[model samples]
Target chain A: MLTAIAIVIIGVLLFLANMFMDNYQLRILNLSGIYIILSLSMILINGFLGLFSLGHAGFMAIGAYTVALLTTPPMAKQMNYYLDPIVPWLAETEWSFLPAILLGGVLAAIAGFLIGAPVLRLRDDYLAIATLGFAEIIRIVFTNLQSVTNGSLGLKGLPEIEIEIPLPLIGFTLNLSACIWIAAIITILFMVRLVNGSYGKAFKAIREDEIAAEAMGINVFKHKLLAFVIASFFAGVGGAFLGNIMGTVDPLMFRFLLTYNIVLIVVFGGIGSLTGGVLAAIVITAAMELLRFLDSSFDMGPIAVSGIPGLRMVVFSLLLMFIIIFKPRGIMGVREFSWQWLIELPQSIKNSSFGRKKLRKDVSK
Target chain B: MSLLRTENMTMRFGGVVAVSDLNVHLDKNEIIGLIGPNGAGKTTAFNMISGVYKPTVGKIILGKEEVQGGQTVTVEKDITGMKPSAITKLGIARTFQNIRLFKELSVLENVVIANHLRLESNWVSSVVRTPDYTKKETAMYDKSMALLEKVGLAELKDEKSYSLPYGMQRRLEIARALATKPHILLLDEPAAGMNPQESDELMRFIGKIRDEFDLSILMIEHHMQLVMGICERIYVLDYGITIAEGNPYEIQNNPKVIEAYLGVDD
Candidate 1:
């Protein structure tokens, strides 16, 4: 009940902010939300499941391309100039934004299934190398798929989707930023539900000890595949949103750097904790943006360390190294934020309920 | 009829024959002791029975079902070579000679994972954290806690299994094996490093759980006092073969048993 009230309160606040917040701030919010989804997906595969998959960006590429191919208007001659010829059927058909995004996710999931089958059999470090190889393979394929993906030239001129909220009292319009926030919340809730579920426990069991998990009758490979596929699906969706928000898709955008960034987010958040992942994603994303101001030389009275171009990267790397050395498990370790932490409200409610139950039993006696 | 029976079970590691021509039968609800010197192949036999190693040649029968854990064997009905997980699902659970608890996981989590074999929740239901999944999870926790209580490690339920003391670690291993709800429990050197007091306590504890759980236990123990105190029947092995099999007292007095434990006199 408190959660419901909190959600309502947050929703009202967001609505008010939506009315007054500048377009640039809203866009930043949307970008943060997309990063959260990507980070959460990373946590699912690497953090909770104990699979080091460095091919998340590959899945994202697949989703972004799929969405671009389906949603881009083929009839517009200007938009088609830099693009390669689309297959006749896809060119003729018109798909909505949501379904196109979902289709991209499905394609990514299929790709994940194919890669996970043989690769998940390998242990730890080998698994990491195999997944890294897979990402490289996907990136190379995407870069060379000149006929379908337009090779390195990339896809352009996507439809700008403007979502509208039909609210009572004060009606509001939702743009791309709003959609990203909605998607992020949905991803967060989906992950929370998943980790709290049986499959999540199975994944954690595999993480704890694969041999023991297998001995206990868990088909280790099957559970790992499930986590891999699900994580890829969400990553693909996040990728589609990212491409749409950027208004273009490029093979170069989905690179090893992106995969590494997601890894850093998950690690910074604390492995195996969804709440930690989100918190870390937001903090990291905002920090990176905030640090951009460092590019302008600060005149601190005497010493001016002229706007160092690579300063942000250096500082970020140092922070990561520090965190790893001091607290390798990350912020929350393997623990999630449970409602049990909110003690006062639940305790009061339980006490009143118990008192009422006792009175009822006495009256009956 | 014997609940579990192994006929001429043999295991070879390349040139070395670890266990050879070993025949053993375990009746339901019986405590059987397997004793041998350091390299006596007692654990080798346990490994074969528990599906850790496939016997090079042997027939293993669990209840009415006969399956091979070591190597491919031609059976009357089919060619059967079951995997360790499959064998475990066939109602055999085991612990390692060296404690092999999932070190990073909590004690409760360890038991919960073991109980996963019997969980009926499908992947979809589990991923959704549905009411059914929660119910099953709660039941699993309750069952695991009960098992922990039986093994006197209920206080360490939230502690990491590896962090427990050596004696408590051994008990936790038993608790974890029991969590699998196996019909037959295999303990590989359950009291390997324990002092006299701890070993005696473990022996008593094993007996209490055997009767309470109505489980058939096959234990590999070097501690003669502990083994002889509880085991109804004991099998003595030497140089990769079973040399003596009888009641604990009978086996204790056997010439071959003395030869195996202490070198034979000229």
Candidate 2:
């Protein structure tokens, strides 16, 4: 009941914000929502199934290209397909944004099934690096399919996702934030349901011990495959959303670094947790954008650092290293945020405050 | 009628034979023991029977079931070399020589996941949490708690498997196997790290599990007291061949059994 109430509150706040917030703020919001969706998918594969797959970028590429191919206007297709005409059927075809996006997810799922069948046979670091190879394979395939994907020139001018809402005497228009936020919420709810189910337990069992899980009558390979395919499906969805939000996509975007962004999110969250992933995605995305000053010639009154092209990356890397060394398990560490946790806050605060008072008294004496 | 029978089953690793020409029979409600010293073929035989390995020669007869249209499915023609999960679905469950509980999961989760082998719902229904699905999950939850109670781990259902005391962890593993509702339970050294007192407790626990679950039992043990105390039938193995097979008293007195396995010190 509280969860339902909290969701409603969030929805109302977002609805109100749609009326007041500027496009710039909304774009960052949309970007964070996309990050949340991508990270949730990462949690399913890496956290629950313990697969440590790095194929998100490749799967996203499949999805983005799918949406791009299906939804790009006829004129845009002609312009982008300068080298070789877009495949005859594709050149003439067009689809609405939502259906095209979902189809993109479906195509990515098919890719996952194909890749997972062969690669899940590997284990540990081999599986991790092998899945990264699958992602590269996706990019390479998209690049070479000149007639189908318009080679490396990429696609642009994706149709904006728009919806109108009318109140009693007022009306508002939905923008990218609407789509991204709605998608993130849907992804979160789906993941929460999945991780609390029998299949989720089965995935965890496979993670815990493949041999023991098999001996217990759980088909380890089947569960692992389920995680892979489902995670890839949502990864494709996230990719489509991101491409639409950015209004452009190229093969270059789906590189190893694209996957590394999600890897950082999952690690900054905790392994085997959903809420941690969502929260970490939001915090990490916002922090990355906020820290943009580090890349430019900005200086504090007390400290000056300027014109070092790679300095921001160095600082961020050090911060991440610090977190890893000190905390080790990352934030939230295998636990999740819950409504009941609200009850524990007062007690924890009281305990800390009581300890502080005692310390202060001892120091004064 | 035999609940399980292996006929001249053989397994070889490259050129070396691990379990050669092994024959064993188990009837319902009987406790059987497989005993051998270090490097002997006891575990290998268990591996073959439990579908961890496809026997190089011979057959593992797991079940005899009448199919639709009155066809009979026998192990000679089927069920051998199947996936371990399929073998487990054939009403066979096993525990590891080293305790291999889902260490990160809670005790209840461990037992509940095992019972999920019998789950009829698909992933979609589980995700949707439909009425039928939640009903099945609740029933499994209650049943898991009950099984944990039987194993004396009821109060510790929410504790992680790795945090449990060693003896409790072993018992927890058995409880997990029982959740699969097996007709036969194969235990790989149920008392491996137990003290003498703990082994005595384990002997009682094993007997209790067999009687209460109505399960036939097969165990590999270097623990003689456990083997001599409970097992009705004993098969002794050495270097991939059966050295002796008989009632415990006969096997205890056999010169070959003593020479091969029983005389070894812990």
iRMSD in angstroms, per model: 2.0, 0.6
Model 1 lDDT per residue over A140-228, tens place:
89888776777787877777755556689787666776677778888887888787665676778888777667666677888899899
Residue-level error in angstroms, candidate 1, position B166: 3.1
Separately for all candidates shown, the number of backbone clashes (residues 3 or more apart, or on different chains) is 4, 0
Which pairs clash inside model 1? A198-B126, B54-B69, B54-B70, B55-B70
Candidate 2 per-residue C-alpha lDDT over A153-187 given as tens digits, one digit per residue, 9 for 90 to 100: 78877777654566767887667677778888999
Off by over 4 Å in 2: A163-174, A300-304, A351-365, B64-77, B262-266
Q: How good is the docking of model 2, by CAPRI class?
A: high
Q: In lDDT terms, how accurate is model 1?
A: 0.82
Total clashes in model 1, counting residue pairs 3 or more apart in sequence or in different chains: 4
Candidate 2: C-alpha lDDT? 0.87
Q: Tell me the RMSD of model 2 versus the true structure.
A: 3.2
